[model samples]
Target chain A: MGEKKFAIIGCQHNHIEIFIEQMYQLGYSCAGIFEEHDRTLAAVIAEKYEIPLVENKLSLLGETIEIVGCASMNHEKIDVIELCEQYGKSIMVDKPAVVNQDGLARLEVIIERNRIKVGMLLTERFHPAIYTLKQYINQGKLGELVHIGMRKPHKLNASSRPAWFFNKEQCGGILIDLLIHDYDLLRWFTGKEIKSSAGLVGKSVLPEHPTFYNTVNVQVELDDGLLTQLYADWHTPSKSWTWGDGRIFVTGTKGFAELRLSGDPLLGSSTPIMLYASEEEEWSKVDLIQPHATITADFLSFIKGEASLLTHEELIKASRAVLDADAAVLYKLIPSSKESEPHV
Target chain B: MGEKKFAIIGCQHNHIEIFIEQMYQLGYSCAGIFEEHDRTLAAVIAEKYEIPLVENKLSLLGETIEIVGCASMNHEKIDVIELCEQYGKSIMVDKPAVVNQDGLARLEVIIERNRIKVGMLLTERFHPAIYTLKQYINQGKLGELVHIGMRKPHKLNASSRPAWFFNKEQCGGILIDLLIHDYDLLRWFTGKEIKSSAGLVGKSVLPEHPTFYNTVNVQVELDDGLLTQLYADWHTPSKSWTWGDGRIFVTGTKGFAELRLSGDPLLGSSTPIMLYASEEEEWSKVDLIQPHATITADFLSFIKGEASLLTHEELIKASRAVLDADAAVLYKLIPSSKESEPHV
Candidate 1:
């Protein structure tokens, strides 16, 4: 419990580095790394970070690792999770892990059977603005929350993305891959489940890449009548330095707050949080208080058979709801004749 | 057509002055004014603008007036339009004139019989951004039109609103008086009719005002694959000078554009139009080319039996769609248990 070793199963998502860096800063030791097949990509990551590379999954699992963080290719995430669960190791996986219904059902079984930690690496959980927002709402600084508008845009380095990245069947479109973060964030911020939702999805930007849904938009109605509109796209033009220029606008009864995540890398910097009450003429930007240390500390406790920062139930439900949100997008769109033809 | 005289038939909405001022600047004569009941308000406006006040509706229509501008209360618009038509006068009226189905049906006949110049004074039509956008799209500078996201926030002078403003039956909630403007704007921008729409309306901000829908959010799907999201609220905090901090975001195949309608009067100014294309690394804020002169000139020409600036059919249809968009908000929301109880 004092200081546990954290190992990784695969290295596909860039978020893996965030987890590793955070854990390292929180005084955790690195054990070893394992990749299913792409040893070249694995070797590149291992050498870059100077971590030991293992021969096989068993070798990494058998090391001093008490917890395994898996950033496997989307299609292979479920299997990698199953392998880690069977070894009785607590696991942390990237977002949109089990996209399809079949994978979702398997995830439920693994979660219910084991007490080992299972967390989706929603790095936004470690973001300072989110914590600030929760504190504001909890203290009634902002009156009754009415609307949460989220924009989550990621820079899709098409060339760097693995073969599975373009497959809608595996990644569940732009809604799942990029937008799902907000779906979870809204729930955690509001403490209310989504009651109803409807939306639109388009692969508008990348006509040559017909299969990739580069843009997605959805409207979600919370159980308590809170209206939320979310737009996520892989529309970050190469000029931007950040991976995602995320944003959230929360409208409450007495006030409004807007969060510009990653400081609109397009602007070279985004204010982490900004708020304005009814009497205020200008928006006040709030300083971000990093939750990474606390988040990593919690994961370390979970690895030591203690309580997790976020409950397994909450994490599982968040993942499930995000996948369900994809259904809303699918049904809302009627196949346009243009879908068959390339966009002009 | 040679400097035709314009007359007013009500002085309820402040936009009536916007119409009068625009026409006057274009060399049209302000013949006279008439108000059904709010004569004190009408007389004050008449004296301030140095225009004479007529004895009645007939007196105003009997002048050198070739076209009548109506800014009657929401409930009285139909009567004013009917009265103007009987006198064989073409009319320009304030937005959301029709508050119900019967009003819409009656409006169709007024348009079908004669030109009657029944144009809804949608001034965003005159805003430099709309014209710049139209030029961009028409010149094929931006590729196929896709989505328009509109944020229209109107200042709620809660204490000053008339008795009818509180009644949805008369004013049609925030969706009717305010949100309807975008519904019309989107149609004009896309030149495509709406195929389907779904949304949520809430009395979220003003709890004391039970029946008033102070907040409304909607998603509209165009016949072709265009998507539009509109958020309207009477919740613009009292700190700003502009009555509405309105904005429109236009997304296209080759480029993207964002328009700030009134500029956040709080910031004291706004970028009227900004565009970014695939090759352009930074967003370019375009200089606004004022269309008010052109729009007013076109309306003046229409009075002489020439083509209308906006066709009657298109204008009426856009108005009808805006009313119907309200239906999407109606059905999407289930009455919350807390709706009956007073909110804090």
Candidate 2:
């Protein structure tokens, strides 16, 4: 990559730091950052990276930047992407790049009209445990995949969150905002398209935020009849050793494997990949080979017309899958008595 | 707890051993054991308990036996229970005491007509981790439970299992056979009744057993709007150190907890109760207080019309739950192309 540069179009979410850090790792300079509203972390990031904080986002997008990184509020991400596409710049943003079905439709039209690469920060794909699990799947350590179960429970810092964070119109529901990573993992590991899906969302806590669902579960049936179940919640206890207790349990024809993406409490900070194959007498922890190729590098390579490990299609497919799941929410549960009444 | 004596009416499943062993633990004698077909395990149990291997089941039932233990094939279990009920003998049997909805209806009628105490061995209730987790929940360590996720993956041991085990009509599907434990745990931990549930079953492996489903997933909505997800399969690798890699993750309003019922690979044989409470600084492994009272003791007490820790109601409820789930299986998959073809 020669003289690669990217500009931050929005910094509403802390996930923007992922893009910034990855860009710097790949020797790409940030031309400038533009956050319409003042965010403490954005300022911290700007000072750390020594990048100018621009007052106007369009001016930053107009820079001779190859990519526009976005971590805006869920609803505002579309405007950033559209502006980047108009400027002939590729884009990278956090998952659920589009909040709802309407935004997804608009995204489809933008991709149809533009040739620039667009990707989401599905950071789980870059985790060492994920890389190892993929290698095991590829090597047939686990025979034809049968099912995958994922649990992603994150701490919800209610007091620290912005007011708009609780609005479904702005933040999207938990399924799209949180479970998109699980959908992407399901597709990537099984190498199959989602044939059908059913979802349920509930607000067990945060009674004040009626529009925001704190608990969500989705079931996906793949084209080849492989099954996947994902449960995501913003219920990680404040005192959790890790931000989340994320896990992936894969069952195959001949064996099974478990990948603890966030460190397991029993195992401390180590991300352990536990495999129990039909040929092995006991479960063995596979040593991870830390991945050198970051998603940012791959996205930048794809933008610069070079070989890339990541593909543009899966990103869109994952987004579409999650949007469909969000749309497919079977039950809009009433917080107290779900048994007698489920309204819309 | 006088000279109580129990007879094994049919000893097809190895789980009969639990009843016999526990009866002996509580100082009850086994009057006799009657197996229509010679099973190695039945013979082993007869030898271990020093019980007579009777030629006729009726003769054994007539031998002043207060309790009749049945671990017969899934379909045959109902016949044994019915005979025991006819003889006015209290019963303790393996889970899914009755297989299908028809059998479940029969069970409800039997329970209404007979005063004999009947219980299924949901032995998970006796697990150390389960006991500890229940304590935490009851003590409000995890304040108002929000959601529960369970994974129960067991080794199929296909060749070792009986021919009838491969027949769905005889053995019940994976959900009924394996996930009854999960349903029972869900009710036990949440202290909430299941309001509505949806289930999906698929067979990704074991192609030859067309009648059986090897994979199952169920989403349950509780009365208080608490959600639960359960995934169970008959796909545990033969060489796995443990029979299953069972896990229960509980999310509550104030905190979260994880119970590794079958020891985690990383934690080895020690079952760990991990809690991340908002009041604590970090995740703490709770010390388990091993229960002196076993499921067998509770059943014996219930049969004797004495105070019992176990209830007669939850057993029927769990059976009803699993049967409803089995009946509620939405898609009858076509194995290869679930996308184009969902037969049911």
Candidate 3:
């Protein structure tokens, strides 16, 4: 296939460097980079790669780009989506796609009216070890799925975030920002609709950001009697960054498989994905797949109609699960103020 | 003090065998074993140990035992407390000492009136590796405490117990049954009161018991701004007689430590404690201490007046924290019933 041309929108995210590198490696030609403002890292990266940085989103509408990669951090996703829709370009947006149901629905309607290809950035699902694990499960290597547990413990630098990132109304807190991956994976592995879920969300150490929840734990029940538990937080101290780890564990009637992505400094900057299987009787260290590359490839394939990418329906469903979990934390599942009062 | 004599009350818990071996090893003479009704295993163990089987609670009270180890799985701890009060004997009671607030209050009144020594069997607090970690923190080895995460996953046999055990009113579900260890440890390590907590609790696969929450995930806020997350479940399948694996990860400003405790053969267990220090150059394996032995030693030391045991005030506070968390789960922190809907 001929190389596809892509433009970048909302270059305020941490993964922009990885995205640009992956796009280049995948033989995709960059058309231009567009941001609401100039002199951002996104613009710098674009300039470093010798790509034109377009200042206005509207200017990219008539460009030769076939796709736009939306890499904006939280709260700016809605604007990115609207611009992508206006250009009628296939787009890949980072999670969470939007902060609330209203924003999510608005974006959904826009994408539907334009018939533009839309994909949510859930790069973890494309991790090479995760892909292999999915293949193993599909081959019935783990028997009938029984239970799944996932932990994503990330330490966010309190000093580094855009102030809006910590506002509940802006980012939807950690449940949405961090746990969207869990919600998607629960559906992906169990193949069961979520029957019910409850979550606990609140500020941990970041008293400076009282409106947002920095820590959250969610318990979800699936349609087929599978139970999934997820714990996500941004409260670990700075010194423990080396031990920052992400794990996915799936257990079945026959055996289980565990995939751990370690952030230990000894392992270096590149996180190795290690997979342990009952059948294999040993844990095999697997090479890491550049998630951004896989995601870009998948998006391109979907746009070419060569393969079906994660559909908007799936993204909406996953988004709703995360939104519902957050709502459960904020309104329904958490105790009322009066109820929280100590009795004695 | 001369060799102390002890009697077992309610010899029905799964840990009764371990208690028996521990008592023997600790140089305590078995006054007798007592249960409401006789079971072959209990009778056999008592007989094998050359300890007579007492007929009832009255016989246990009437014995010359200086200590009573209430190992009953039942939550009717008030009766045991009353017996210990009447006999002026010290006691170690298996936890969830009383299932409800009223029962707990009554036990408290009786213990206060009798002025007898008591120990709540919180063996997890005394777990060797956990104690070592505590020591490191107490000595400022880990620097400023930041965040703590713990998980306990287990499988219970359907034929194992009476139906009442699954009832929240009776056994207090997974929160009190499993996560209490974590709750206690959090308070122990932080020396801070739990200001607030929220939890998600629900039944997943154990359809036989719909009312009981087989899984729980709790996020607790401490007065010191420490965030702690705990997960507990009793629905994973077991391959052998052993079930459950536990992990505790503590992250501090200076370093971090991760502890894993494995379950029995039919149940999964955790790996031994692994300690990682950023200041130090290596990851080291720490020794595991026998928890029950430590509990026994603590009780003995308290009885000898060499050290003060965990006070009633501490026990009540810890129990209150656990119960409050459970209540949060039951009430659904948010007011909307729809938000409490399960996803699975």
On lDDT, the leading prediction is 2
In the range B58-121, model 2's lDDT, one tens digit per residue, is 8877646778888888888888878888888888888769888778877888888866778899
Query: Chain B alone, model 3: TM-score?
Result: 0.86
- A187-237 in candidate 1: lDDT tens per residue? 888888877667767755554555677667788878877677888766555
**After superposition, which runs of candidate 1 have C-alpha atoms over 4 Å from their true positions?**
A1-4, A205-211, A240-242, A264-277, A292-294, A301-309, A331-344, B1-4, B205-210, B240-242, B264-268, B271-277, B292-294, B305-309, B331-335, B338-344
List iRMS for all predictions: 4.0, 2.3, 8.8
DockQ for candidate 2, please give it: 0.61
Clashes of each: 2, 0, 33
Higher-DockQ candidate of 1 and 3? 1
> What lDDT would each prediction earn against the true structure?
0.70, 0.78, 0.66
On residues A1-344, what C-alpha lDDT tens digit does candidate 2 reach at each position? Answer: 45778899888787888888888887788988888775666787889889888887777766567788998888888888888888888899887798877788878888888667788898888888888888888889888787898888888888888776788888876787888888888888977888878757877566577677788877788787666788988888888776777888998886688877776656655455554456564586778867668888878777777887566677789888887877777545545643221221
TM-scores, one per candidate: 0.90, 0.94, 0.80
What residue pairs are clashing in model 2? none
